[model samples]
Target chain A: MNLKRTTLIPLDDDSLAESIFKSFIEKEMMLLMVIIGDTDTIREAIPKADNLAQLSYFKMERWVLWVRNYEILSETLKKHLKASDADKSKEDYNNIKCLCFSPILDKVDGIILKNAELSYASLQQSFFKAQAHDALAVNI
Target chain B: MYYLKRISTLVLVCFTIGIQAQIISVIENDKDQKRTISLTDKQIVDINSSLEIQLSKLQLLDAIQQQFPQLKQHLELESKLIKLQQALRNQSAVISILEKQLATASEQATFFEIMNGFLTDIQNDPLLNERYNDLMAKFFSTDTFAPGTVPEPYIFSNLNNDMLQIEQELASLEADIYAVSVLAFKKDSSGGDRVHIQNYDTYTNRDYVTIKRWVTSLSTEQKQQLEALNDIAKQNNLKKTNVFNELKIKLLEEFKSITCIKDFKNNSIEFINNIQLNDVVPTEVKNKIEQLNLLITRFETLFLLLKTDMDQWQITLLLDIKSEVETIVTLLKTIDTNFSDVTTLINQTRVKTKFMPLVSEFNTCYATINKDFETLKQGAALLFNLQNNYIANKAIGTEVLAFTLDNLPDKGYINLKGTGQRKNGDELLIELVLRLPSAVENAPEQVVTIEQREFIMQLTGPRSEVAIGLIFANPINKEDLNLQNDRNFFYTPSAALLLKFGSNKSHFYNDFLDFGIGLNFATPDFNTDGTPEFGTGIITTAFKNIISAGVNYNLTLDSFYWFFGVNLPFNLPGIPINNIKN
Candidate 1:
């Protein structure tokens, strides 16, 4: 089956990301995500963002973090793979990777994650891609 | 004024004519005993019932007369009792007055005779014997009887035969003392002991027993005095007896006079009530009488007509008058054997030649009186029937007849019931019922094999609707064993018009119509293998098809809370539901 992703805008003073996550839970889907620290917040110098609580089925520690600039995307990926021990020489790394990130449109991006699995490198890469798309759309 | 006077004269003439027309001859023999012959059904019924009632009354009277002498005597005494009572009163007064006088005079005479005897005794013995001398001395000394003195105020004292004899006591004294003295004492004293020497003892001892032993001689004057007093008393009693006899005779004569007049009046009323005097006779008889009377005034004309006519019709018309008079006389004789009909025959003889005038006179005599008699008879019959014979108000007479149809089995029975009369009307009902075990539920429709279905049918015909109504009264006591049975009832019920048909026994069934509904239940019978072939449940469906809209009920007796109404079925067959569980 072909996979597709849909984004929801944050409501005024409301957790639009959490609402989307809850819709996934009602459909009994396996994975959910929320993007934080995007270009809109960096350019405006805003800090102290709220985080959604992780349910028992999904842990907050598995969430991906990303920087905003496209130039840092390669650098962010290189550090993430090292910290995740992707260079452990001959070990199989495909199943160990729990997530991946892809930029499809200016403020839109894709985050792929394995159901009920986690990895350090996949989280860092997905985070950096999400931030780049947010910065690119904010700059325009 | 002239017209008014003329009118008055005319009125006076008319008033005289009216009086002349109403001049009813007080014929002693006339009586009306006419019977009404009615052709109407209602009148026929009334007359029949009236005849029955009168016959019963006559029977009662006859029975009383036969068995009770008091009743016969009462009838005989009833006529003369008033006069007899008056006579009895008069006679009783005379007898009582005469008796009072007789009683008083006789008592007086007795006292006088007694006084006379006493006076005689005094005169006969001037010197007096010892006893007489003692008594006379005592009598003269006592204040009550002293000589030449008034005796006891009410006491009688008389002098007799020129002797100063007290008539009242002198006779008694002589008889009492002298008889005893002579019997007891001899002429010479023979006894050795002298029992009495004092005059007082001789005078005081006057009793027969005492004197017989104490005295020896008696005086003849005393005996004569006693005899005369007894004769005087007897003569007084004889006179009183004559007076009583005379009073009794006088009373009887007076009673006879009043009773004769009363009897004449009663007999006169009874006679007038019996004969239909003014009743209209046949026109033919009237014409004949008229012709006979006319013949005398028209003798010359009749003689001229005699040459012209020798007609049998005219001769027969004249003969019919004689026959009609004979018939009337015969009828009168049949009613009262003692009636001579002499006045009728004499009147007919005087008018024998004046036929037309006699017919008019006789018709005039009987017609109005006949009308009056008819009115009285009708009124009396109505009054008596309504007053005494109208017993249907509260009196209920019931008669029940039960008959079983022979065509059915022994278990099957039919009863024909009839009630005598209740209140005022008659009611009739009939019921046909069939009771079978619940096993019949599984049986085929044609499985009515037992002879006549062993059913029981009942019919009740009563005289009134207020009486017991048509009802299916269940008598079964077992709750588990439901004994509801199939019932088919039909008969004409009580109603004004229907009750008339009930009186005619043959037409009773023809006029009556009825319909009924019921339920049936029972224990299911077992098959050969002990399996119950029939199942039980409510069997409420019912349908009745009659000429009218008969009724259908689920549970007719259950307060009619749930029922099925059958409305106007036209020639429909019985609708049965065997499988209630279905």
Candidate 2:
């Protein structure tokens, strides 16, 4: 066996950054990225994703995501600042793409996801429907 | 005085002899003389005293001659010995003069060593002329230490602020790169090796741990430099901060690879190219060069001093200088570490005890650098040696064949007969591969076969050459029936040597197969209990996958081969459980 040749591929800045993120995630399993951008843009219509269900609720071992633009809240900084560069000011306008979002509470058992999202009237009706169906299913 | 003593002893001896012989002689000379009987007190006392004194003088002379035979060459040794003793009391002044001369010589040698070290330091430093002047001024001045003057605090504070600014700039740059997901940076103005640290996204393409390590090293260096300045400030009694000390200790614990070779005209042609000043060099590089110079001088001095210690070989001095060089190399590394907790912990102990941690860290970081330097050094020496012993181009063209054949004849030879050739006064490599098969009863229908792959490279020089070969075989064959008489092919090559043990190639092949003999000292392939009972030649059906039915001499044996090599491959013929519907 012999080494025939070796080639190094050139990558654009954004792609290179994504590749670096992927590599880190592969090595470390789960990592956090704090992204900063315009607040309204992030809050508008939900972001398009290839694997939404897998990402929407991270139940598996490893997951990754990009925050649209949640500007940094440091009082001294004027514009949105990347979390990694939070130590420095954002006058240079370095955007942080991914900010870590981990939920501390899991209230799914007490209040189901659908019930949690429903209004008071819809929640009451849904609760009744759940109880009735559950009782019927148990009886049968 | 000597004659008087000798005369008295002679008179006593004569008296004693006369007494013993008196009666006999008296009879013979009775009429000639009458014997005197009367004696006086003064005469007796004088005779006794003379006898005692004569005996004592004789004893003294004998003792003097025994101890100082050289002293008797010109004068009576006894008198000369007494005079010599008296002279010792008066020679204290001369002894002192000799001791003073010895001390002066020693001091002069030390001064030479120190001067050589200083010269080397100046040679290595970038600001060579300025450093030379400063060193000269410092050396010439009487006060080595300016006792009470502290360096200004504001200078260090400014340095700290500048470092902070650099850190801030780096942090900002990092954030921008992360946002953009930029993983790598193209080689810019400085060099191809440089990587922009701020962009975490681009860093994903590289080993994060390794990258983190490099950045940590640079960060630590910058921190330590600031700390050193701060230390200078503190020593001068300037106001000090706790962070500088912390930084120092951290830096001390870290080991950074040295860049001592400077630069190449290109990476390949360093021999013809001169070292450029801009290349990254090791820390304390100047001091190290000076230390090396001192060692060389010390070696030279001791070599010169061999004449003085001719009775004993001068190797003692040479050994001392070599040991000193090794110690200095270690010392330079130890001194390079920062003044952090690690440094403090190490420094708290004696120098002997403190060196352990410092050396371990330096070794860990400098491992790659040291390996590279050693390779370059060896390569340069070898190339020089080769150049000096130039070989003719015509001699290199003569090809030498190196092939290993199995004990079985025609079916087992991988050499493309005599096609090998040398090029440009260098050797070309040729490898031999062969397979042999043998059969047995009470087993699978196909006979078991052994596959041998022999790797050999023949260095055919002018008229003569050397060949080094290794053979690795799989599924080795053996003959059995009698425990002691069983013969088997070796599973691996047994020998490696640099010798010119020659034999005819044809005879080697004939004896190897016909007589069932192999290379001398070749390790046996199988033990008595495991030797296979085989007959016909075994052949492999397909490469790595299908094995020709092997005759199993013993059905109890789990694996067919008696022993296995380190590179023994384990694979079962295809029995796939899963298949795709195409």
Candidate 3:
């Protein structure tokens, strides 16, 4: 049995900063962005993530995100995915779409994603869609 | 053409009766060509962890003498914290009661004594004596009860008695079948490999060898230039610390993937094809990039320091230089990453026509920049290793180990020997130990003796590599391998090597059915009287959920007892419930 492929994710709820960098060294998880629940928290998180993205060791090909762990929150995930199929007039309709685009990454990036998968094309599309607007708020 | 590998390994056999030569080399030499080696994620993590540990070792709070202890303490406490948390959860409610009892006793002693007593009580708990037994299954064990849990069994049993006895735990014992979950030990990257030699377990720390003993070509002029580079790096321009990345990010904004598909294809072909190998593109920002090519020339001179034993001042001076070079290289990589992504976008089968010429143009420029980046990384790592003082004679060392991620193997073992301890009692030489599964975690650090011991080496990985360890048999720790317990029901010999029949595609966890017979020095037997019917106790292992149901017979008793690999949990007052260690 080849163990190099075996991935172990020890659930952590401690310091998100240490957890992110420590797990970055682990490389078992591929985190593109860190989705945050609180907008006020982005000030601290974005720089930490920026430091990670810029770290010489990480050598990130693309930028990481500071989104929500909507995928793990299954009910929130279903609401967002189903909202995309419904009317587009809802207050948070677009934010829900971006959050649902790849929600599993919220818990552990690169988990056996069943809801949706992340790739360069998909990420670029979602990124530009948000980049055109206020950058933080997903356009409804 | 996907990934060009230039693999070169230099082997200096550390221990043996005779000196042997072993080397692996690969090269399709094109000067200044890009060489990329793909590594598995696990391998990358291991290397990163190893480097992190190496860095931590250099950051001592007090002095060099105290550094080892602090680093060792930090690592041990972190790993032990996981198990300590589990034990704490197991004894949550009782902790406050125990604390109050200790608090009442503290009225007689000093605060320090009370604290010591409190710690002693927790350590002495028999149930929490996790180190002594297979409480490991509980330590890092999954908390999920989805497997083999016989739920809602509180009803229907022994209804005829004055008080009906519903023993659900015992009811499962009637079945001869056993179910056991498979678990593999995680790799401990803190430091040292704890290997068992004989009756006692001896651990050895990381060993270092010097690189390149040949005469160095570092001229007086080259040293002066490198010093200038180092000085530039040492300047703490707080505002401009991130100038290189900032400039690169701004430059990338201009080169962002052209949105219009027509412009993307046409502009890429035109812009890429227009790029000359030796010419620089027009830039509007000052990012310390103008002298990027010249910097590579300075870093390449580090390769000449093969024979030069650097003084502490020079080593410290060069670290800053290393930092500057890496900063420049990283900026270059950002460019490469963008270039590669744009090229990857167009290299699809649908656009094969523009692909070849576009790639042909891109590779020409990419090769030059890629080679310089690779060289800078190699130079930086070599300088870092020198700072760590892991040096040896260059005559025997053919290749310097690269600290960079690009060139490392997906899986391999590095043998670091513990050079004998220090003469001064106050000194702490780093102790390297290749830990086995059953190696005592809390064993007190002791002065390791120097001796070349014979070993029966076994290599096991979930993949083709079997193991990187020696074979030994101690009844106390029967089989101390990740999958060793899976082959639990066996005669553990004084020395035994695992035998496998090509099941290459299977994961390390998923067990396939197989049977083998091994000779045992001490055989086991179980008696109905709650004593081992034989001298030694029998152990059973559930392989791939295939219940190993066997009967052991003691010739003296002339009685048969059914044994299952999964020991059943029972409530008999005097008998050992799950374990029957002889």
Candidate 4:
């Protein structure tokens, strides 16, 4: 399925980055992919994400990021997320379980999550399911 | 002796008869003559008694003549004695006849002497001489008297009546002369001989010493008689002069009185005219002028009988006075005209002085009010323009949305476009499109339709430009947004620095619409229970660079809940900040 959504955010750089980071965390993904311009803050955040997954960085005009399994990120990494590119294509995502966070995502096939659809129960359900699957796989 | 007595008695009888007959003829022939002799009763008896004595004596002589007729022989010696007695008788008769002639001659001489004295007295006085000649001409012109003939005693019979008439006229004439002399011949109080007659009428209790002297000099009577005569002549000359001086003083008074009246009348006329021509004449002065005029009019009539007697000086004076009166009348008329003109001019000046300042003040007030009215008119017109732009722009937003919805496309991408121009040089090109989902139940399988709307607004003329602004979340409500009670609400307070490119229109600092920004703060209290809302959003207007309206949008639980309402830049009520600009 192809899905698209748009959101208006505050003009402040910190608030913009927070909005992008929050969307990324809600998706519960592992393998992280990033597209960023040549900036020092993004270069530093790339090494920190190695504990969750192998980091791939591409130099571009706008910021774009992808995560595979549920992993919590540090606040410093979230503050730099506003540089993410929002208008990306479907061919950019390699796996079916990938979660993308951007200002705008066009011609991408996925389930759209907005403020209306993200309730407290849905977030808790996603967190527990991810935890249960991880414990089961590790024991086996 | 008896014969002698008888002859003498006869002779006396014949002589008496002859005398009686002559006397009777004289009395009978001149019956028309006015006799001066009026006999009394006692004189008639005395003459009759004397005639009786003569008749008795003649009877005695007759008896003696008869007894002596036989005694002729002794008559020689006796004739001598008788002759002596006859002589004595004849002498007695002659003596009686002479006595009668002597009485007649004595009466004639006494009458002539009295008349001659009266004429001499009149001729000797200057005042009387002039009038005596006039009177002689008047009286003798009617009587047939020879030149130098003494008037007969018969003419004197009417002397008292003539003198009475003359005295009355003289009295009138003297009174008139006294009045004139009172004005013209004033006696100096200082006892100087040089007389000053100016303003003589004002002198009181004056003694006319010069007139008295002139009167006394005209007569040679005793001092007492002269004084009495002067006093009588001055006091009641009209009554007493004819009796005392036998019409001599009366004629003198008449002549002088007539001459003086003529002279004083001319002087009075001149005096009155002078008074009338004075620049300022009091009531008393005017009264005096009228009195003098009356005196002249009366005296002119009174002196008419003396017209032939008027001297050259009197005629000249009258002519001069008439001319002077005419000149005074003309001068009075000129003065009256000038007075009327002066009164009118003063009134006009008074009115102008009283009202001029008030008129000037009124004009000034009118000018000030007119200027204020013009300013008010311009302000009203500016406000009207702002109001019209606001209504038109708001209507365009709502009507365009409704029109686009009415022609919605069916489940496909459809585009609508419109273009218009605003009065304040703003141009608009609106493009709208509808995108509908293929199926709502497909759940994440189909892409959600996106609605696209674009408005291209630009300035189309000079003094026209668009203002750019920024919108932001309000700091007061930034932390209050939560899902429990503020699920679909947000608020922002914004500030914008407006830039107008290619236009010279200035901006107001407090006007949010000019900057295209406003403050919008709202909370859950503003919305209905269970109803989701987008809260209030206030936008500054760019129409003529003024702050205009605000919009509140609300999205309900099941649909979009919103409405359009007007807003002010400040938290004040009513038609926003446009009123302040005006």
Q: Candidate 2, DockQ to 2 decimals?
A: 0.00
Query: A1-140, model 1: which lDDT tens digit per residue?
Result: 11123233343423543454334433321222333223443222111111110111111121222233223232323343344322231222221222222222212222332231122112223333333322223221
Q: What is each predicted model's overall lDDT from 0 to 1?
A: 0.26, 0.27, 0.29, 0.30
Candidate 3 off by > 4 Å: A1-140, B1-505, B508-532, B535-540, B544-548, B567-582
Give the per-residue lDDT of model 4 (tens digit) for B322-422. Answer: 33333433433443354334334423442334334433443443344334334433433443343333333222211122111111211111011111101
Top candidate, metric lDDT: 4
| Tens digits of per-residue lDDT for model 2, B1-582 | 999999999999988744432210100111233222111111111000000100112223333345436424322422322222222222333233323423343332332233233333333333432433344334323464242221112222332454455445444442211000111112223222212222111111221211010111235775796588668746643222233333323422331233321121122122112112313323243234334334434433442343233223122123332343344344434433421323344344333252454345444544544553344334334432332222211111111111111001111111111222111112111111111111353221221111111111211111121111222222333333233533453333222111121111222322222111111112223343454323222212111111122222223222243322221133335522121110
Give residue B111's lDDT in candidate 4 (0 to 100): 29
**Candidate 3 chain B, which ten residues in sequence have the lowest lDDT sum?**
B46-55
User: Which residue window of length 10 is worst by lDDT in model 2 chain B?
Assistant: B45-54
lDDT for B72 in candidate 3 is 44
| TM-score of candidate 2 to 2 decimals | 0.12
Global local distance difference test of model 4? 0.30
The residue-level lDDT of candidate 3 at B557 comes to 48
Candidate 4 chain B: worst-modelled 10 consecutive residues by lDDT: B45-54
Worst lDDT window (10 residues) for model 1 chain A? A48-57
Among the numbered candidates, top TM-score falls to 3
Q: Give the per-residue lDDT digits (tens) of candidate 1, residues B1-582.
A: 999999999999987644333211111110122233221111111101111110111222233344445435432322122222221223333233324423343333333333333333333333322333343334434363422232212111111111222232233332211000100111112211111112101211211211111112245875786577658757864655444344334422332222232333344334333322424333343443333333322432432242233122131132232333334334323322222232233245433333334334434433443343344334333333332212211111111111111111112111111111111112211111112223344331221111110111112232111111112222222243342433222221210111111221222242234322223222222112333222111222222112212222223222111112233333246632121120
Error of 1 at B32 (Å): 38
